[model samples]
Target: MTDRYAVFGQPIAHSQSPHIHATFGRQEGLALDYRAIEASPGEFLAALEAFAAEGGVGANITAPHKEAAFALCTTLTSRARRAGAVNTLLRKGDRWHGDTTDGIGLVRDLTDRHGLDLRGRRTLLIGAGGSARSVAPALLDAGILELVVVNRTPERADALIDAMGEPGRAITRYWEDIRELGDFELIINATSAGRDRAAEFKLPLSLVNSMTTAVDLNYGEAAIAFTAWARSAGCRNIVDGLGMLVEQAAESFLQWHAVRPQTEAVYTELRTQLAPLAGED
Candidate 1:
């Protein structure tokens, strides 16, 4: 029987996981049936149970369900523990195992794909939600010498820092407190603020410079606010989360099928498809 899998989210119609996973399965010659499931907030566990009962080998969790999935997991990878969010779920001997691959995905895209170095670099992250939580531990592990997390809610920033525990080194700042931050080697926008069609968030121009590279964790329509700001601010390189999305799906695919699919081709193909959407935006 073909292994069953899916990506679950509340508003899942917008997810690209199905396409990415289909490419992965085809490339690896795996018998897999992956689809997108629109899960209700309260129905997450029920949906997981139903899918598992139907022989789902694994599934990917998104948005509102990441924390719920983390809470429901029988076991968690170290990264998942640090993230306090679970974006990937594996079915193991009648139990659901939770792990987050977002950080690894971002790091892989940054270092391996983009040829960017993280060691001893100053990194600024501009969100304190699940996306930031999922990527922080991995970014710290990637050898970033310093990281500052700035959020609209200072308490959220503090909570992210506290959840991270004693990082090798990290700091928290409020949006208003970061006026003097500048010349960051890497700046990541992990906020959900861009979801609005008229996103009004603005950054301190000092925080970015010619040397700065910006990454927005939300892709498509949601990334425009930050990426557009990055471009306007004279930042040379700006990346959205699409690559991270595929790379994370690739990791989940590996967990289910034990086959590592070549991501470059799929990435290129996805990028081409995404370009038209970007243009539409």
Candidate 2:
């Protein structure tokens, strides 16, 4: 039987998961079908159960569903436990196993794909949501000296730092104190701020210097806010989340199929495809 796989999340219509997985399967000469499954918050568990019932071997979870997926798992990888979120899932009999590839994906995209040296860099992470939680440990593992997490809700940032269990390396600061934090070698946006068309990122330019790399873990329209702010602040290396998306999909593909497919061909293809859509996005 051909392998059945899917990604589940609300607002999933625009997901590139199906395309990325299809390309990966084709590269490995596998007979597989991947799909984008839309599931609202109330419907997520039921929708996932239905997918698993239909021979689905694995799946990806995004956005608001990561924590939900984490809770639904029978077993989880240590990284997922640390993240308190799940972005990848596997089925075994009637049970689900969960793991998070997001952090490794972001690290690889930055270090391997983008030629970044993450070791010893001082980093600032915006927001304390699941995405921020997902990447924090990985940055520390990659040798970043310190991470300052700032969020609109100070408690969420405090909770994230507390959960990280690295009080010396990870610290929380109020968003209002952003200007006082000084410059960082890296600034990562893990917030949902840009998803709304009317929302704009108003970060202080003083937070970034010419050597700083600014990244938003969101792509397309959701990335506009941080990207606009980064450009205006003269950040030399500005990135959206597209590369991380493909990289993480590759990690999930390897976990399911035992083979890692090359990602640049698909990444370049998607970049070209999206270039024309940039204006509309």
Candidate 3:
């Protein structure tokens, strides 16, 4: 029988997961099937249980369901534990193992695809939500000189720094004080502020310079505002989350199939497909 896998999310019609995974399976010569399952809010657990009952061995959770998926896990990898969220799930016998590969995905995209050196770089992460939490430890492990987290909610940012267990290396600042926080070599927007066109958030132009790399953990329409701001602010390297999306999916695929897929081809193809929709020329 072919191995079964899927990605779960609400409003999932636009997901490229099925295509990405199918391409990966073909590259590795593995007989498998992957699809996107739309689960309504408050229906994720039920949807997941039903998938597992049908022999689904693994699945990817996105957006509003990642924390819920973490709650349903029988076991968690260290990364998931640190992130307080789970994006990838692997079933072993009757139990599900949860892990978050988002961080590794972002790191890989930056270092391997973009050729950006992260070692000992001062990095600023905007937001303390699941996206930021998922990538914090990975950034630290990558030898960042300092990791500064700023969020609208100061307490939540403090909590995330506490959980990362590197107080000396990581610190939290209020979003309003971002200008005072000084510039960074890398700045990542981990918040969902860009998801809505009317969502108002302040980004300090002083935080970015010609050499700074600005990344938003969102893609397509959700990333347009930040990307535009970064460019106008003279940031030479502005990247959306498309690469991270593919890289993370690749990591999850590796976890399920024990094989790593080359990401350049899939990423290029997906970018081209999304270009028209995203207003890219």
Measured by TM-score, the strongest candidate is: 2
Scored by CA lDDT, what does every candidate get?
0.84, 0.89, 0.86
Q: How far is candidate 3 from the true structure (C-alpha RMSD, Å)?
A: 2.5
lDDT against true structure, model 2: 0.89
Against the hidden reference, what TM-scores do the models get? Answer: 0.93, 0.95, 0.92
- Score residue 273 of candidate 1 by CA lDDT: 73
Per-residue lDDT of model 3, residues 234-270, tens digit only: 7768788899999999999999988899998999998
Q: Candidate 1, residues 43-116: lDDT per residue as tens digits? A: 88898898888878889998778888999898999889888989999988988899999999999988888887
Residue clash pairs of candidate 3: none
Ordered by lDDT, highest first, the candidates read: 2, 3, 1
Residue 227, candidate 3: alpha-carbon lDDT: 79
Worst 10 residues of 1 by lDDT: 272-281
Q: Looking at candidate 1, what is the lDDT of residue 161?
A: 90
Q: Report the CA-based lDDT of candidate 3 relative to the real structure.
A: 0.86
Instruction: Give the per-residue lDDT of model 2 (tens digit) for 96-214.
Output: 99999999999999998889999988999998888898888899899998999999999988988887899889999888899899999999999888999889888888898768989
Which segments of model 1 are wrong by more than 4 Å? 276-281
Stretch of 10 with least lDDT, candidate 3: 272-281
